[model samples]
Target: MPDFLIVHTVLVTGAEGQLGRQVIRKSADQEVEVVGLSRLDLDITDLAAVRKRIAEPVTVINCAAYTAVDRAETDADAAYSINETGAANLARACAEVGARLIHVSTDYVFSGTSERPYEPDDPTGPKTVYGASKLAGERAIAELAPTSTIVRTAWVYTGVGTDFVATMRRLEAERDVVRVVTDQVGSPTYAADLADGLLELAELAEAPLILHATNDGATSWYEFARAIFAEIGADPDRVQPTTSAEFVRPAPRPAYSVLSSRAWGAVGLTPLRGWREALHASLAG
Candidate 1:
């Protein structure tokens, strides 16, 4: 709790992404200075480049990733380069600089077979290349830089970025009925809330070994879409709940990968709100 708050520099990768940009906006209330970068500024897969970027002692929050779930089947090398290799590079550099590394990850690391929420210590059995790659990144960080905080979130959305919420909003304007997979269940995390949680964790003197940073309650994509429709004052009946088999993609998604924030709570961090409540706030914004 020392005054490390005085003009501390924060380096956020994938600044143009939904989560990164939210971190930028939310950090306005803090005393720390924030510098954000997209792939153009730093391709994290390059170890030398990452080392150079970490020359200054600053908090590094890596939000960069190849998130094309379906495309990952055909382009796994590219995904691994960005997700796995890039994470390794960043973790090594953070260790060199003694900086806290906050790496954003996904719930896809699990096989989605759990009846309850996955804990931080839960064994990861990824079903797709994208999931496997992200899980690899988590493992790399844990083995290489145990001081780093690996945040595994799920179904993230923001008003400005390309996410399910934005897609649903756009589709609602054109289609009378929209079908979403109901069997695949996870929490719909608001990027802004996740950003806040990261900043809080970053400023802390000690970061957790691992944490689940999603919104509290869980729901399938179908129920999530229905909630979105209702929040926007659209007809909930227009949102149809379907199974995953009907909407098959190139990558196999998890049937259920909701993550629990028990690890984060162990360190006394405030948990995020429930999905519906957070979604309402995002839509309003």
Candidate 2:
């Protein structure tokens, strides 16, 4: 609740997702109004519904995305519906109502072959349908709502549902040994931490059109899984390191996905805590 940033009513488009729910919970103590609508309540793919629902001047955080990576390879249409067209609908609606649009995107926008963290303005070349669709959404928003904010994050999980953290926790309880991908590297972002950051971004009046926000550091999936095992009182060695080639999927995962938070800090926003510390907090909670 800073004096510089003024917020009244903020609308969330994907309330049922873990990130959306976390943002709503975090907003309780902040000096802003956050209203959420799940897909059941308002499907963003429906332009008529988008216009009908969003008529006031408010800050809108879009969290709805087609996230099924492997499935998206075969279901590109479905992916485009939610990721690209749906985002376009919201952009048009926000522009018409003079509302601020803060769209949540993915680091998958990049090909993941870079040696360092991807900057906000880095050239993008997505490797999967899911990634391509999200990138398309980013472009659509840029064209429709030129001033809208697009924040790209990576490897986000809430230690629930089917996210990587949740899967690791379940495997630790069910099996003796688990093999995680070491060749693939990225920032493991806890959804709660990201939720807090988004709420902070919603309050800021002046921010870059595109920004990258994730945990401070980066690690491979195998290392991240080992860390998760250690946090939950399990043996870290039980998790074995492997490469992406050993475990191929229908859609290729980015070999590297660390997103740079330098842009986020340059804007005078609070830097998110480091990944290991944030992971401990998430498991402890």
Candidate 3:
């Protein structure tokens, strides 16, 4: 790694988010200094605020995003403001201060029609406002900060947040049975694992401009729910599998949003552990 890649300070935006919190926690043992800023401290949509906050030569990991998938259908403007314009603001600020950016993205950029895992350079056909806004963010960062690394991950969950694992655990306690969508398939990435992968990329002198980082294997939401129940010593039999048609939401979900990890592997970093193993670790923590 080049001397420049030897990070001195890391500025993490969206510091209160699931992945952002993990990044902060994981970086404690590292030699570099880390500063985490929540939306209350720094709004990425405000260019002046972003510029003022990122005035130093530090690595900027943008975990901030408008993540309301279903609400984005009715609130496209709000989503675009944060996901697209906010990303552009950060990119521009990083370029001015000579800070490398690691922008977190989503797998929703793809249509999910591919039989195989989606690659970094695959054509994007976002099916929802949320997906389109996220894709716009990726484009803005790429165009404004050419040296930035864009990491696209999917099905991310953390123990602390209102994620899939938490939701399933709550429903299991309240209901007799839980119905999960079986038609949709994707890799479940623990926020902690994803955070570690982003930091690993931060340490590299050279990495792919675009990479897919997630847990090794893929599974449907139904399988994931069952695994979650098994992890908590609950009745896995209480988890029921159902198709997407049974419970429709405003935003269209991709049927297959699994992303390939070949790009991350090519950069000499191992992919994350399988979803089941990560889930167990997350629950145990």
Candidate 4:
């Protein structure tokens, strides 16, 4: 890290996550000192552990969340443990240290009924427990520490984890055909792009910054899967488009979770690439 460049310590939770890992790797080039902690190293749900960790003055990036949308319906308690209480703990800790917290939220915070993209200040009406918990997390973070940022993103995918893109790739390799829900519309965000946005937020000396960061364009899972197939040189026809009713899950997904980047721009930060461009880049990797 450079001495004159105002080097700061970054304490990143969920270090093994796709976005968290990307943040750690990319910070190297930017010369930012990072303290990446996995669940084993530090679990946010444990208040004692979190309080101890945040005693140091460091920029905190929380990427941890119970993200299994379907499972959350049956396991709301588990979801709330990490997403609600855990978030509050981290926020309070950040407040104690007088550090800026960059918390990653989700589009599920919205009901997804709007024809237009969701703004940062829009009213939240979560339809599922996962959504509700994530929204709680956002609120907790904001209320506990006014100097925190809540970044809502959607349709996230990366080389790691079992995301939509990876699932599509797996199905393409095995099945002759695949069924995807077309009713849900949202932008697919590359973890790498999101990581960059976090870095930008860390550099800013602002408080209570709520931003929506994702790939620019919107698409349904059907379209997203077809694009993934096209990139992988697989048969796009094999990926069949189905309605949400036909592909029922335990949790209810928002029909449209598209988020606007207007708030991110307010801070003079450019939005991420469009879904098409990001999809191509992730597939290439």
CA shift at 38, candidate 2, in angstroms? Answer: 0.5
lDDT over C-alpha atoms for residue 235 of model 2: 95
Compared with the true structure, what per-residue lDDT tens digits does model 1 show for residues 1-285?
786546889999988888889999999998889999888899899899889989867999999999999999999999999999999999999998887799999999988999999998888899999999999999899988899989999988895546899888988999999999889889989999999999998888886778899999899889999988999999989998788898888898898979998888778889999888999999998
Output the worst ten-in-a-row residue range by lDDT, candidate 2. 1-10
Q: Give the TM-score (vs. native) of candidate 1.
A: 0.96
Model 3: lDDT of residue 284: 93
Highest lDDT among the candidates is held by which one? 3
- Better lDDT candidate (2, 3): 3
Could you tell me the lDDT of residue 94 within candidate 2? 94
Global lDDT of model 3: 0.92
Ranking by lDDT: 3, 2, 1, 4
lDDT of 1 at 156: 88
lDDT of 3 at 61: 92
**Worst ten in a row by lDDT for model 3:** 1-10
> How much is 27 displaced in model 3, in angstroms?
0.6
* Candidate 1 residue-wise lDDT at 22: 91
Residue-level lDDT tens digits of model 3 in 57-121: 68999999999999999999999999999999999999998988999999999998999999999
By TM-score, is 2 or 4 better?
Answer: 2
TM, every model: 0.96, 0.97, 0.96, 0.96
